[model samples]
Target: MAPLKTLLLVVVVLLPVANACQPPRTLHVPVFHRDALFPPPPSAKRGSLLRQRLAADAARYASLVDATGRLHSPVFSGIPFESGEYFALVGVGTPSTKAMLVIDTGSDLVWLQCSPCRHCYAQKGQVFDPRRSSTYRRVPCSSPQCRALRFPGCDSGGSGGGCRYMVAYGDGSSSTGDLATDKLAFANYTYINNVTLGCGRDNEGLFDSAAGLLGVGRGKISISTQVAPAYGNVFEYCLGDRTSRSTHSSYLVFGRTPELTSTAFTALLSNPRRPSLYYVDMAGFSVGGERVTGFSNASLALDPATGRGGVVVDSGTAISRFARDAYAALRDAFDARAHAAGMRKLAGEYSVFDACYDLRGRPAASAPPIVLHFAGGADMALPPENYFLPMDGGRRRASSYRCLGFEAADDGLSVIGNVQQQGFRVVFDVEKERIGFAPNGCTS
Candidate 1:
């Protein structure tokens, strides 16, 4: 009896030490693309089709925002463009199934196509059968969770039945379904039970192959917020390089304290119009060390009243978009440099770009570099590899069409698209309200 008592005492003392020495909870998952979701493959040298899709989505994304905010209840969509290039594998339901979820930092709700579907977009794998999962639980409309989503007071289903949700994007894409709580499994074999998410039934529009969305936005119901209790208030993602043509997957890291070696810093702001988006301050822009003129500081400030002039680091957008005035300056600067180098202009081209160069005579490596200067000493340099693309995109041999990667937009908001973000690790620190950037993110 005395020996047993001594052993119990030893375990009680050692257990605390063991746990204390353990590292903070963390999650890391791979993010990669499967295939081109929409029709018309990307242009080899210039991603015209890709740019169109992203720009259209960005426009719609800006329009749908009310600027009134969603503090009381969350209302947003993931992969609202009807297509997504990259997705993350998320395990949902009991006896977990690995579901390919679209990655969208612009949204906050992590949704999945649930079983007993009435209407759903065609997905790659088997639909999640809630009946098979013991952990599956439908949230009632009266529940606090449902109420917070503004439940809409149930539907024709019943007065006190499962909560229903509907989110419509500006481009007419929408998801109508029930709100429920289920276990979400991650790549690290760690999971959280009763993670509130939308179990979409009548999901419509152009979502190719993705079963759902992994919303990593700045909202109360976002997956980042849901897991913040255990993982802390930090997440980092290193978008893999598209030029490498390698099979290595990019990564998404969540931790209590983000590990960063970057000296640059930028303040994350808030706008009532777009509450879920991660807004950051952009002090100014510089093209090869030349500051843009007529681009006032007020042009890019966040304003809910006007519903314009804000910036977000989005994972879904492929290329970067700048305000009309700002883009004109940037375009002229880049075009002037290209013209000085004796590059020929491709005439008779009807495209979204203002400057399209005929690169058949010169390698894409010859293009000049551009830099986007952010607040707090963050200067993101865009090498030829980051902004220049072959018109043929290696689709065929013996083709020479390389163009600069940039676009003009009428919207007041500016975006740091995924293309410019490639080859770097972008850290979204909501706790500190700052963003960090580091090179060589894939291996880091």
Candidate 2:
């Protein structure tokens, strides 16, 4: 057989690019719920998918808290891959081989499962082979990209070889490989060349069937930061209804879009300890137009000294989480309104949700409106579907139950998950350091 490197050098022609006056001002990529990775079997239980997701959510919350505890450590650790709920199709390399990558706003490194498995987990598609791409190049140890990694390593052969990366998650899942760069392309025909990435050769985890992760966090090496210059450090995303199998396609957009405009804007908080995570000021919450009392600014404020307490807007976690006390207050207020509205509370189990209601005979109006009160005047009015997630996976039968999607976090940091973010265009303006919420923004 020919030498591996020489054999992969076969010339292949590619189509000419359309008249490029620079890539589009914004690029749109379709995103989907993790359940879309594969079709369920005929005998699969209707609620099994959601039940498993909620179990993963619990583990995800635990991992998030553990990751925060090691904030000052040199290791780059984060939530488990099995905890990821949404994914987007991404293209990489010269010819742009497509792969399904978890769209994560929580981490900093962008990596994918590569060819030559050294203990690779089973994935839906063929692993990405860097040798097939003409533009593929290994990042050297001396390069700044390698230095940016929190857990960067040098090739065992010495400093002359490619830089190495080892990312270990809280659940013991890890990806170790050489740091490299290639063309990162989108479906819109726009592409960014020489984008740094990890070509994982030794990988293991409960990543499901997805190829890898696409980090869009605020770290220097994150895709959002690396592509910030061209896109003006602005991007927006709107998650579709995850409970519906026939829902419209969700989107992850880079750069400004007409739908990103929102009347309500909140100042982005910063925690020097964990700068990669998006922080927000959550003043309080309301159920059925009545403001839930007992939650003060300190209840959700970021601790300047410890950098521990605060709220985060994350895309990977399945359910929104809040501080225990704060959650109890919110739950009580919701229960009061639910009782007054004639909605019957169920003693049955539904994931971590303590407030489950059987709305079979109750009118739609009986379900109270839940609103998030931010520091600014922005009042995010969540639709019934956003907060009252259907207990059944995709079944909307009259016998089904809807549960409050919020849960109590084990730690101080509260996370607003994708479930609550559905149907709203969430704009992350890194340049201005503000986050915007536009209602009914998932038109596409």
Best by TM-score: 2
Q: What is the lDDT of residue 359 in candidate 2?
A: 78
lDDT of 2 by residue, 1-444 (tens): 000000001101111111212678777677877555555666666476556556666655665666434321111113222333677788888677888887777777888999976877777777899999998889888777777788789887677778999887555667889899888778567777777789999987666677888888778777777666566677888887665574346788888776444547898888888777788889889888888987666868899799888988887776788888899899889888888877778875566788988776765545789999898787789888788766664545635577887888657788888778888888888778888888888774
Report the lDDT tens digits of candidate 1 across residue range 22-61: 2236776667654422233343324444454544544434
Model 2: per-residue Cα lDDT at residue 383: 88
Report the alpha-carbon TM-score of model 1 versus the true structure. Answer: 0.83
TM-score of each: 0.83, 0.89
Worst 10 residues of 1 by lDDT: 1-10
